[model samples]
Target: MDADTLRAILDAQAMQQQKAFDAQAMQRQMRHQKTLDAVMERMERMFSAMGATPAGAPASTAEFVTNSLSTRLPEFTYDPDSGCRFDVWYNRYEDIIANDGSTLDDAAKARLIVSKLDAATYARFTNHILPKKTFDVSLDETVKILKELFGHNTSVFARRYAYLRTQRNDETIRDYTGLVNRHREMAEFNDVTPEQMKCLVWICGLANPEDADIRVRDLRKMENNPQTTLKELSAEIQQFVDTRCQALRKPAIINTVWYVSQRRPHWAKDCDFANKTCHDCKRVGHKKGYCKNFTSKKKPIPKQKRRSANNVVTARPKLLPPLVSLKSANNTEINVRGHFNCNFNIDGHEGRGNCHEADTTSLLGLDWIAQDEPLFRRLTKGAICNVSASKLNTLRTSLTKQLQKQFVTVFAPGLGRCVKSKAHLALKPDAKPVFGKARPVPYAALPRISQEIDRLVAADVLSPIDHSDWAAPIVVVQKISPTLRRLLYWTERRTQATPAPTSNA
Candidate 1:
């Protein structure tokens, strides 16, 4: 045979085989199609009888019931009008059944359900299904009957209202959010209700609206970002609540005024006082707030000596000076490091002020403050304080007082005179009396000199005569006392020097 004819023969056989296979497949498909149609029709009728749609088709959504499981639940103890969510309990019941480790048939399950029902429930179920037995119903139909009979059909509007009204109620934000979501589920709030909407709902239902500023601030935060998710909102709000709880638990400084008010009669109405007496006032009606003998006043700042150093120990200021670069008259920039409130004792005067920190030398510029402000007073005696006369005088005066106290007779007041012996002036024979003319005394010096002469004469230390051949000029010097400048009498007359010993005899 020719190659082309052989090929044609082979093609024809292959085509015939393919057609046969196609026909066989079509016959099998037709047979299976008939069976599927019958099964579907039967299922449709069964679903129709059961008042439900088949799982393959969309049916009216069944309402769910909720039950309070405040305690652990027992078997099949369902109450129809319990106003609780039934789907969750049903799932839990299914779990319980699944964990039973036994394959229970439809009749067995139905009978078990009927047997588990209370007497009242069993009677009610029998009456509801009168003229028919529970065992005769399919397992699915029995479950459906129990659902409709013992479960509450939650109203969409009512569930939504409850979701909207859900509040924190002192519950944690997580718990509050869960409660709201559960209600939203019952309300059939699908994903069409965005998370943003749920977040707004959560914010609106904050338990204590007037508790703090956090809620108002959080609302403002959400206003700026309308796309905030429930997770973000919950997380932020939870963090804020945690911070507030921590602050509340932290110890606070005792405010005396608040403390006193707490014990006040008007404030302490809740406290029992009939059998008690106040130790402060020793009166029954007396209140702690009105007591005048409280010793718990704020501690007074201790007095401290003034220091010349720029840095000092002080409290941190609540409001600090802004970091400003200061300029001197020469335009030298001075960067401020920090600022604080300080208590200062400058020149023996106490003052409180806000001080700035800088590396440059500190200056109490009169330009900064008003001159007439009369800050700290100046030194009373400003005669070169560098001498430290008062400090040395203190030591000398203390010692002098001690010596006078110890030897009262040896250290006499005014002037000291020797009663045991007298010194005789020994002069050379050629020594001559040199008298000097009296110099003119200024008006200021004249009063001081006359006062000194009168004091000396009163003490009998010097004798003043109306006429005197011997005379000398006196020098006037200012005294340290404030009363008057005492003058010192100085005579420059030459005197003979002769060594004379004290007569021990």
Candidate 2:
């Protein structure tokens, strides 16, 4: 071969190799474009199914394809535990199909639903429908079957009744009415009007029925008027409530004084001043100048008796003995038989003796003795001594004065007084009888205990029973000193019963 021929042949072979490589690259590009076209078509269908459109107008097929590929379907997965509501799943699947622009036939939709079902739901669907050779059912038919299997239709009636009976105390009228309407919708009652529903809800939801009849009448009138809205009716009801609250807040005028006066006479009006005495003549129904003794001068006007600093009769000062002895030898012992003792320490001086022998100087220093000298003398006089007529007269005057003063009337047991407890003790259902061994009373204290028991029984503080299932032993305890005894009803034994286990336990 020649050099020129060899060079031309080499060029032709290189060109042919390059042409073959170009043809293979063009084929690969065409394949890639076909794959991309298929992908774009699928994405466009998905975006259409999802109800989404491209953001802007595409100038070319490539741009349109690119935009379509960018669109995405919402991500959702079936969950059996989510709920058994077929409507919810159906709606979601419907959106998915629409977004994917899927031309799913009834059978295809059924298959898609089966694929989306969780294991349990899938098994259930197949077992229930496939057995009847109903595999190729429509979406609606599948939903119907599923609904019949899991639908809460049975509970709807119960819920409706419960809803109707519900009252609205804490919630607003509008909120309560809204709940009622929602429940009514769920109940799907036939031949019910909006007016009827509103009236039923109003009547049922009213917390206060003080004027229920009147309210019902008003509601009926409103129901008849087509122009009256639920809002207007609610406003009226709210106004009524406001007015009622305001009326209740007003202070009630109670004539307590008038009522008491009606029950009893006025104290001032009932008081009688006619028996008041005059200080001048010591006589009733007249003043000092108008006194009969002073006006008539029937007898020598008795001189007004004067009292000393000790409130003792100064007119008879010379008649009484000296209050204190000047010499120790003159302190004679005077024995008096009486319960009154004169053991008083006054002004660093001690008076220690019977009431009759009490030092008059010490008694005069004592304010109590000075104010009640007549009573003191009467109480201190020896039991065997003959009381003089004048002293007896003084005692009578003191007694009469005390009797004339206002005093509270005390009704004792003997006077037919009775007392009752406000509330009686209520024992629990599970209460157990408390049993305790009786404590032995001390031999020396037995008489005292018996006397105390007798006193309590007589006073109705304690009652004797022949037998009792619940018994708390009596315990004697010393109080103040060993000489004083108190009978105690030991309640520890009664309260120590084994407590029943609680619910939490």
Candidate 3:
């Protein structure tokens, strides 16, 4: 009983009669799949009560390409820097349109899948299915929108962890059991690996260490054969892997001893590979990874001191912590290494501080991080950009109308008035007239600062003075604008801080 154990017992009785004809064809397809799932749930509730408009008014994919046959659908060139992977060129373009003996319809294969794609994926499929083109779509709605742009698929738990770590390395055993029977339905294996542990992970990937002597004589005769059948342990590991690849493709004759008088004969002069040593040049006659003066020694480069941008890289083993005496506001001696408490994380915001450690930095003071005004506006926030007047849209309207006609009164509107600076009311000996008081304004900014002080008091630049005894109190101060970050409704909130706040661009 030898032709590989009688062809693994006639392929385990033809996989037990194909598992009894697939359990009698799953009991005759469960009564025609429960009457085709109740006639597809009554044709999906009569097309959702007559809605997707499929009545007589529905025939346009250019009336199904009215006649085209002599086998065509081919043109599928790829190149997006062609290292091939768009789902392996869309499954070699659907296996060349299912072995193209063309019955071309679905609008000539949806205009040959958008005229064979690739000019940057047909410019992103004409910006995702155009004002309807490619003769207005079809081939199963353009291969479901080109499998939602470039068909990916992979997942079933990463193809069952790549078929439980597929192993046969230098390929053959019939292309490693034809890539484990084309991923055996991505290793679903009765869902969660139990057809005897998917034949013990395809017989532990043919026991790999370069087939450890075909795992001690052919996978220990099919791992104790509990009625063996990952196709008879892959035909008994392809019959001892074609008898160890035809005994490693033949020609091997090296039992060396031809020595006329070249010494070494007293039982090969103390054997043990003539006293083994050479762990890379310790010299003796080839042993630890055979090294006839093999190279790699390197280690000498250590120069580094040129530092200049106001040089300060002093960290060579200097951690003397608990010291205290400090004194700086013009009192000088503050080299304090003492003050402690610092826990503050920045983006993933945890807080606790009071720190100092200052032997030249690690201070942490910003008045206790500016007393957390929302973590000081999320650490001086500045990355949110649907234009906060990108400095007035990077202005170049003819260089902003040639700098607004060379700064007309400094680009004047209602305010910019400058007469080369001058101001003086330094009253002299016996000075007196002083009555300045009425100020309460901000009722939510009193009607927008009273319409910007009545447009600077109707642009005479202000002249409403009915009482002036050298008047002085005038404080409106409403300056900070860019609409407070555009009226503050900014929502994107992710700060659970494992140090993730990045924008240096």
> In candidate 2, what are the lDDT values of residues 221-241, reduced to their tens digit?
554663455677777778877
Using lDDT as the yardstick, the better of models 1 and 2 is 1
Residue lDDT tens for model 3, 406-431: 54445655455443344443344565
Lowest lDDT 10-residue stretch of candidate 1: 61-70
Model 1 segments beyond 4 Å from truth?
1-73, 79-86, 96-102, 170-178, 191-505
Deviation (Å) of 144 in candidate 2: 1.4
lDDT tens string, model 1, 1-505? Answer: 9999999999999999999999999999999999999999999988787775354332222111012221234545444343343355566676544444134445655565565565445655666776788777776787777777766554443455456776777789898788777667666666435775676577666758564576565566665675678898788878988887898895878856544324343446665664466787876755454455657577755455334222255533565774556787898887777776676655455566667788789866443232323451242235455554658878999999988755554665565544334455555776554557777777766765787788878666888779754457766677889676376666655444322243472
Which candidate would rank higher by TM-score, 1 or 3? 1
C-alpha TM-score for every candidate: 0.23, 0.23, 0.19
Which 10 residues in a row give candidate 3 its minimum summed lDDT?
485-494
Using lDDT, rank the candidates from best to worst.
Answer: 1, 3, 2
